[model samples]
Each structure stands twice: as C-alpha cells, then as structure tokens.
Target: MRETLLLLSGFVLLSSSTNLDVLLHQSVPYSPQSASTEQAWIASLESTHTETKAQTTSTVEGERVHGSMTREMKRQYEIAAYRRTKAQARSTPTATPSPRVATLNPIFDKQDIEPEHRVIADQAFRIIPGHCQAFLKNFYVRYDNPQHRGLGGKSTIILTGSVPDEEFRALFFHELGHLTDLGCFQGTAVAGSTPYMDKDEQIWKDDPSVSFYQISWMNSQAHNRGTTEEDFVSGYASWDMFEDFAESFVYYVLHREVFARRAAENDALAAKYQWFQEHLPDLPKVAKSNTRWDGAIPWDITKLSYDWKPPTELVARR
Candidate 1:
C-alpha cells in the first residue's frame, strides 16, 4: 500500500510539471520584453497610415483636378442645399409663386437695372441667362430669418460687400447669384445654404486638401478654427448658397478682370485668358473673354459713385 501511494504521488507530480510548461508556452507573448509583439503592432499602424495618405494623394490627382473637384463638390452641395430649402418652404406654408408675373416694389423688387445689364452684357455674359432680373427676394420675407446682418437685411440681397468700386458690378453679379438662388425669378425657394470657395490652384497648394469632408463631414475640420467669428469663418464656408453662388458669380465677374489690372502693371489681360481657360473646363470659349465681366456703366476705380437715386415708384415697402 505504501508503494502504491508513492507511485500515485509521482504521477501527480508529473502532471503538474506538464501543465506548468503548457501555460508558459501559451499562444500570447512569452518573451521577457514582448519586443516582437510591440514591433508587429507598430508595423501594422505604420502600414495603415501610409495606406491612408496614399489614398488621399490618389484622390486629388488629374488635369484641372482642383477646379474639377471644387465644381463637382459645389454642385453636389447645391443639390442637397436646394432640397433643404424646399423642405423649409414647405414647412413654413407660405405664399406660393404667383402663376402670373407680378410687378415688384422698385426698391424692394429692385431699382437698379444698370448693374444687371453690366453683368449680363459685359461681365460674365457667359453665365447670365437671358432677361435676367436681379430680381428681389421679396417673397423670402416669410422664411427669411435675421441670422447675419453682415451688410444688409436678413433677406435683403445687397449688390456689393466690402470691395473696391471698380469691382462692384462684378460683385453685384455675385449678389445677383444670391438673388437667383433665393427664388428671385425661379418662383421656388432655395432649401438650404451652401458655401463653396474655389481658390486658385496655387492658392490651394499653399494649404492643400480642401476636401468636401472638411465642410460636410459629421465632425468637420471646418468646425474647429481659430477665429473670433469662428461660426462665420468655419460654418460660412459650407453654410450659405449666397456664398457659393456669389463666389462662382465672382469668378464670372473678375476672373480675367484681374488680368486686365495686371495688363497695366504686367501682361495684357487678353493674353492671360489662356491661364484662366485652364481653370474652367465646362464653360464655352467666348465665355472666357476678358471683357465678359465688364459693363456699360463706367467703373470708378476708387469707390462706388452710385448717386443715391430716389427709390423707384415700384418700390413699395411692405
């Protein structure tokens, strides 16, 4: 019986030793420093980062890539924005577009026809639809909210912001874009605002990566900026149709006009059309002419000489 007990004890000892070895050799790290495990994990992280950067670089490469990307994004944003405004218009349950054309209050409807003629006939003649009225945003009063009285009324679409006098007509063309977007003549209200700035390629190269996600992403990079008017600086870039249309309209206005200015200090503006042409692919050649963004109204290079004309009779204030 003593011998049997000794054999049994030996067997138990053997089993315990085997179990200890198994645990020590388990699948997880057994090394003293675990240096290999850490190295493998780091390698994985580096690979992932490299892949992501490569993807970013690949996405933004092509001919006129910058302009193409900007235009495509702006169009995408415009579609979505219009939808939002459509919803708002429906939600408000306001007045409908008159089936028949109605006369506008001259001051409210619009008093200045000269600017319209300039933008259409001289400036950005390529973009101006025939019989374009820098129509008033009169109907928008129902839905218009006083958010940013940056320069004018909540719905009041002013002709120019803080730009020089010579540029007001072109600038007015930009505001006209806001007017057009706000159902100025379409008789339909815009659903939302979409701000898209397409800076020159050289300009973008300095900062790099103006991704739409910077504006549209759930946690947009545009949301976090260092500025006193952070909301305007960040959200403004993506929020308002007024900005997008205005900027695009501005391109139509002063695109080659900048060249005209340089013609005095540098090369002829006409010669620079080729450079501008490289920027806009969708537009026609004639649309690219340097004179297109000019006007019948003589431009005062210093400041706006708009003599305060008496408000037109049609301009009946509500």
Candidate 2:
C-alpha cells in the first residue's frame, strides 16, 4: 500500500517503492528576525534574574532575628515571605536560561513511546550539533509501519516503532539532518508563495546548501550539467538535493574518515565534504578509530553502525 508523505505546506503521495526512510514536514522559513527576538527575550530574563537575586538576599537578611518572634511578628513574617515568594514566581520565567543565544529545547511527547525506547531517543537527540538542535521544537514516538520509519519537519521529529538502540540513533540522526537542512539553513522566500519546492534554484541561491545541491543536481529532478551518482554519497543521495544533503550529513558525522577517503577519489564528493567542514566546523564527529572505509556504499547510510559517544547533556547554540 502506498503512504502519503505529509509536508507542512501540503501532502505528496509516495509509491510503496519510494524510500520513505526520511520524510520532511516543512515548517516556517527560518529568519534572523526570530533569533533577534529570542536574544531580546533572553536579555530581559537576565535582567530579571539579577533583580531577583538582589531581592532574595535582602529578604533573607531582613528575616534574620536573634530571638524567637512573638505571635504578631510571626504572622507578619509569614505574610511577607508569602508575598515575596509570589512576587518572585511572577517575575521569573519558567524556561531555564541556556548559554546559547537562541536555542530551543525539543519538547518530547513521550506518551506513545516505550520507556526504554524513549531513553534511546533522548540519547540520539543529544549526539547532533547544537545549531541543529535549536531547530527542533517537538519530538514524537509512534508506530506506523511503511509510513513512519522516521519523519522530520515542522520543527518536529517522529520515529515509527521500536528498534535496536543503535539503529534508532542512526535513524534519528538522519531525521535531524532533515531538520538541520530545513531549519538551520533556509532558502530565500519567494513572494506570494512557499519557498521549499526543490526545483526552484532561485530560492536556494542564498543558502549554503546551494553549493552542495549544484554539485549533483541542476534542479531537484535533473543532474547538475554533467554530474552523476559517482558524485553522490550513496544511492539514496541521488534521489534529490535534499536527500543528498541529509545522507551526506549522516555520513560525515558517523563515518567521517570513510567520507573523507571517498572524497579523495572524486572531485564532486570532495566539494560536498568540504562544504560540511566549512559550514559545520564544530559538529561532533565519530572517532576515526571507530570507523572503516569499506568501499561498498550502503543504500541507506542511516542503517550503518559506528561507535557513538555516550549521551551527554545537550547544549543549545545559535
């Protein structure tokens, strides 16, 4: 049976034979304006925090007494403390301050996910770069065969059913690649219409992804002038520029040495690899000792396994 791939702006039905491993639900075009607004909000929070700290210190000093209080004094102290607590609560924001300027925490709707699976999902989410993490807004766990291996879009990621931890992690990383492409790096907005149609090179010109897209794709459906599969990271990457980006992203992260070695042989592959290095210089890479450059390319790169670092706290960044 064929399944429909849901996009934020519209839906496109895919044949059963189509690789549905990674699907995107397009979200709002990311803009610097949003980041600036978040920066302003953060500054306000810092100011409020400073004021609250001073107020709390003063309150503590005032409340100190050498002797036991009488009934009247006790009642007044209780009221004052109650009022102070209320005031502080009102002033303080619920969201914790992050070191990064405009990063947002991914909200996990874990009601559908098994406890053990949720743990694995959390670990996978932490492995991606902080800039990509900022693009995620919601995460969901679901069970839908032939439809939901993994879906990312609308600032959300949805994982289908349970699988081995490593496989789950790899799948999540691929979905994150989608989020990173759509969210962190956005195309220019076309007037009076959506900007995500893969065929439109004009919208993509401002994006770093354009360089990668130009290497293998003239548009979304055609190859760039003379490029071919030899220039792509995997068979799956040949599907389109978006898939090319996501697949290349996963390869670069999970099998850096392998990707580099492959790049040495092909000029197109080398350009793609260099793009990642120049754009995401600080992205975490799987240790070289843990990866091997088997000349054979997996049709689905996300299914491969490499030594992944233990989960650490996710740091937010712009």
Best-fitting candidate, scored by TM-score: 2
Name the lDDT of candidate 1. Answer: 0.29
Q: Which residue runs of candidate 2 sit more than 4 Å off their true CA positions?
A: 1-106, 127-131, 144-148, 190-196, 199-202, 287-291, 310-318
Worst 10 residues of 1 by lDDT: 1-10
- lDDT against the true structure, per candidate, is 0.29, 0.60
lDDT of 2: 0.60
Worst 10 residues of 2 by lDDT: 31-40
Residue-level lDDT tens digits of model 2 in 39-100: 11123433444533212323332755445456666567668888889999999889966654
Off by over 4 Å in 1: 1-127, 130-134, 137-155, 159-163, 184-241, 256-318
Model 2 RMSD vs true structure? 11.7
